[model samples]
Target: MIFCIKLPGGLIKWCRVINFKESASGENPGNLKTPSCFLPSSKEPVRFNLYTDFIPLQKIVTNPNLSL
Candidate 1:
């Protein structure tokens, strides 16, 4: 998934969130602080909304068990 954090001065930066692995590549995971930088291909898709100016959008409920 993609996590986008909006800065105080209207600056938006996005990061790819993923599960933490003890050994991503048998290398010291501690050395690699940013795991997203070494993600494999075919990752989840992320969209950059053109009209959203740090405004929250209404959640769409598709599942019958979901609620607002």
Candidate 2:
């Protein structure tokens, strides 16, 4: 899975999911693992649960008035 995060400076960070960890408790049941940066960079991937540090991005409908 691809995760995109918008920084405070209006920069978007794109990362690829590396692994997943399962949990029995907590608001987020599972965690997603992703690299801190893309390849060619030397940062290790980190694990974060959904709804905590990040959430799934949903499709935006810019034209609600426009007919499909």
lDDT: which candidate is best? 2
What is candidate 2's lDDT per residue for 1-68, written digit by digit as tens? 56675545676776664343223233343332322234223254444444354433441255445442
Q: What TM-score does candidate 1 reach?
A: 0.25
Residue 12 local lDDT, model 2:
72
Clash count for candidate 1 is 0
**CA lDDT, candidate 1, residue 42:** 24
Best by TM-score: 2
Cα lDDT over the full model 2: 0.43
Where is model 1 poorest over a 10-residue stretch in terms of lDDT? 47-56
- Quote the lDDT for 2 in model 1: 59
